[model samples]
Target chain A: MDIIVTELTKSFAGHIVLDRFSAAFPEGEITCVMGPSGGGKTTFLHILMGLMSPDSGTIKGVPSRKSAVFQEDRLCESFSALTNVRMVLDKSFDCGEIQAHLDEIGLGKDRTKPVGEYSGGMKRRVALVRAVLADSRILFLDEPLKGLDDQTKGHVIDYLKKHFNERTVIMVTHDKEEVDAFDARLVTLG
Target chain B: MISTMFRKSRLEKAGAVFLALAIWQIGALLLDRSIILVTPVAVAQRLFTLLPESDFTHAIAFSFFRIVGGYFLALLVGSVLAVGAGHYHGLEMILWPYIHAIKSVPVASFIILCLIWLSSDSLSVFIAFLMVLPIVYTNMLQGIKSTDEKLLEMAEVFRMSRLRKLKYIHLPHLKPYLLSACSVSIGLSWKAGIAAEVIGIPDGSIGEKLYEAKVYLSSADLFAWTAVIVLISVVFEKLFLRGLKMFFDRLERS
Candidate 1:
């Protein structure tokens, strides 16, 4: 069954964000959630990711084993890229696979350096790499390429398209170009 | 940049010590009364002479280990209590009154109360433990409370293990707070511990020698013993803090 939201409502400080809004995210498909600023794009993503609860709503068919690239990098700043990626993996996990992905994302040369020293775009790719590498049935991306240049963005989009072919992906993005690149089913909200 | 800062701090510390000793020497010379104010040289001579006696080593070891042991015990128990209190508000509420009382009451009063139940030989350990516990506990709880909510939420969604959550998220948040607590509390514990020993007048302890110095009108012995306490306290603080710094350095570099 598809992940479904019915009459989801949320408010903060007497201001309503999502009010009786409803949507569906089909399983095993790339879905893009799009909205202008202050349109509850982040709020919706957070609620769907179970980072928060809707004030009043019912969400059905949300899967376990979820992975996400939060709006912030949320990477451990004191650790290397490989360690950050390896953190979510099992004890017998190999670093070679994560290393190759980091190389593909232009972070191979800097993979051993602490994330604290990484630029914003570099950190974003590390976060993306972490999400892609983690074992999860559903992946959530919140503007995962927000700080990247077009060339790097293209490189990362290619990576996402290559690795996440069958995994359920929900991307929160404002850029129509990005949604188009993913060939994603779109849901625009307020 | 870090190395330069370290060297600068060391130099500053040396300069401060020199200035303090110069002032002390000048005061002793002007007073010209050996019984009232012992010169720095006289104190140093007394220290060297005191060191050869077997009782000196016994006194140093007796008080040092018991006091430092109490600190280590408090560190362990305080961290456990802080983690518990951080997880349960009701437990924290129950502990809050006692913690506040411990913090507010004078160290002397606690020593006297403890003496009624404990032998003088063991008084320093209990007093030291009591002095260190609340500080470590309170700071650690603050550390836990101040951990980043977003990171914890990330951990939750990732289904991260408890060990990983502690290592990756909680440890980093607690490091500075715990280290600062160690710094602030180590000095306090030593002072309280020694004061307890003095009041209790434990045999084979530095406090006994101090009591002897006071009753004998020996200013040089008093200054020498007092200097010994300061030196021991400072040396222990530096060594323990250095170990912590090394651990953090390895953590950050790794």
Candidate 2:
């Protein structure tokens, strides 16, 4: 089912952030929410992820099983990228298949090292891999390519589009090119 | 390669011991009073002389069991209580006053009170457990509280099982706290445990030997027993912590 946001309102200490905002995210499509810094884009995503509650609003049709690549990599620092990805996979998910996907994202060679030693872009890739590997009906990407260089970002975007074609994806980003690269329908927020 | 590694480590340890002995010898000479400060040589000689006696072994065993038993018991109970309190704030609130009281009360007062209610044989274990519970509880609770909420959120989203969450996230975060608690509390348990034993003077215990030494004015025996306690405490701490680290390492690899 497609997610529907109706009259979403949120505030922090009497400061309005998202005021009666409404939008709809269709299933099996990539939707990008773009805005200026401090424009409640992240707050909206946080509310969607159930990390926070809106003071007044209604969100409907969001999948119960969700995965996310948060703004921070949030990878387990002491675990390997392989281990991090494997942690979210079901028992039926094959290890060799996951390794092949990691290799496609340029993390195959460093699969054994702890994520703590990974570069920023590498860690981001690990987080992306973990999100994609999880068995979620919907995926959230919050500035998922923030730390990646242009070359890696292009490769990851291609991988994401190809693999997540049938899953609903809601992405929050400040970059216009990212919306273009993912072929996402743009939803602008003030 | 294995033999060479062992040899190198042995040499390094010996060097450290020699350096420490030199410092102690210099300090003892500066103090210049055997009553106030005994030299390493004197303590070693006293220990060597006491080694042959069966009573020495009996005393060591007696105190070692009680103190170590108390430490292990505290570890079990404290970890359970920490998990309980972590999961339920109401339980934490109820336990707050009792934990605070234990922390504030003096060890001597507790010992004296315990003497009235309990036999001297188990006094050391009770005291050691009391002293260690608060430390383990506080550290583990803080560790549990400070666990990465983001990871927990991820686990929830992915519908990870409780066993998986514990194995991957909770246990890893708790490792440092548990190790730190063990390092700090092992010595405390021994110190407080031995003190309780001395006050209670349970038969066939190190505390009894220490009290006997004090009554007879055998300063050498006293120093020797003190050294034995230090050695046992340090060795147990090192061994226990190493085992814990190895367990975690195995978990990580598997």
Colliding residue pairs in candidate 2:
none
Which ten-residue region of model 2 chain B has the weakest summed lDDT? B32-41
lDDT of 1 by residue, B1-254 (tens): 99999999999999999999999899999999999998999999999999999999999999999999999999999999999999999999999999999999999999999999999999999999999999999999999988898889888878899998887888877899999999999999899998999899999988888889989999999999999999999999999999998887677665
lDDT scores in order: 0.91, 0.91
Model 1: per-residue Cα lDDT over A16-55, one tens digit each: 9998989999988999999878989889889988888999
What is candidate 2's CAPRI-style docking category based on DockQ?
medium
In angstroms, give how far residue B88 of model 2 lies from its true place: 3.5
lDDT of 2 by residue, B141-201 (tens): 9999999998898787778899889988999899999999989999999999999999999
Sliding window of 10 residues with minimal summed lDDT for model 1 chain A: A86-95
All candidates: TM-score: 0.95, 0.91
Cα lDDT, model 2, residue A119: 93
